[model samples]
Target: MTDTPSPLTYAPPALAAREDLLAAVRFDAAGLVACIAQQHDTGEVLMMAWMNREAVAETLATGRVCYYSRSRKGLWRKGETSGQLQHLVELRLDCDGDTLLALVDQLGVACHTGRRNCFYRAIRDDALTTIADPLMDPAALYGDAHKGHSHG
Candidate 1:
C-alpha cells in the first residue's frame, strides 16, 4: 500500500489488468481459492470465503471486495444484501498463491450473525465458549435468508 488516500494497492491499473495476476494464482479444481478478510486498522480477521478470477478482477477494478459463493455458484459481493460492506484496503497473495488476505475497511458488522467477526467461538478448557456477542440482530441484516450457517 502506498501513502495514497485510497486504501487500494499502489500498483498501476495496467499491471492489474494483465493476466499474470490471475495466471499466477493456483485455483483448485473447483475453480475456487480461499480469501480471508481482515480489518485494515486493527488487523482483526473478519471472515473467510472463496473467490474466483472474476471476483479478484472485480475487487481490483473496484475498491469493493467480492467473493465467490459456492452455494450460489456466482459472485458474492461482500455486503450486497446486507449493508455491512467491506472496501478493499489491500490485497495480498500468500507465497504459495493458494490463499488471499484482504485488508479492508469493514463497515458495520462483518459477520452475518451481526458479530464483528466470524470467529466468535474458542476452545477453552476443552469446552466451546463464545468470545463475542452479536452487535446487531442478524435477521435485520440478512432477512433470514442465510440462517443456520455454521460459522464453525
Candidate 2:
C-alpha cells in the first residue's frame, strides 16, 4: 500500500463532546452500525466490522478499536485474544450517519486468518483469486482456542 495520506486524513473531533457527537449517528434496527477500518498512515483498507453504541463509546474513551460481535452478541475488543491490536487515530461518521470509518494504527495482522487484512480475495482475470497470502499461520495467531474453527 502507498504511504501517502489521502484527503480522508484530518483533525478528529475532540473526545470531550463524544456523547453528543455519538447521539447524532443513526444506528440500524439492530442498534449496530457498519464500521470500516483503514490504516491511518498508508490508507490501506483493513476490515469491516459492526459497532454498537457501547462499542463506539468505548473506542472513543479508550482510544482502542472495539466492535460488536453479532454471533457472540457482545462487545469485541479488536485483537483481544491475539497480539494484533488496532489503536484508533480517528473515527468518522458517514454523511448518512449510518456508517463509520475508523482510522487506526494497526499492530500485527488484522485478520483472524493471520493476514494483514481481510480483503485477501479479489476478482482477477474474470475469476476469483487469492490476492494476498497470510503473513503468519492462523494456528500461531489463535492457538488451540481457535482450532478447527472459522470466523463468521
**lDDT minimum window of 10 residues, candidate 1:** 3-12
Model 1 lDDT on a 0 to 1 scale: 0.82
lDDT of 2 by residue, 13-59 (tens): 47767987599889999999999999988889999999999999998
Q: What global local distance difference test value does model 2 have?
A: 0.84
Point to the candidate with the largest TM-score: 1
Q: Taking the tens digit of each residue's C-alpha lDDT, what string does model 1 give over 74-126? A: 89898888888899877878999999888888999989888999999999999
lDDT of each: 0.82, 0.84
Give the best candidate by lDDT: 2
Against the hidden reference, what TM-scores do the models get? 0.87, 0.87
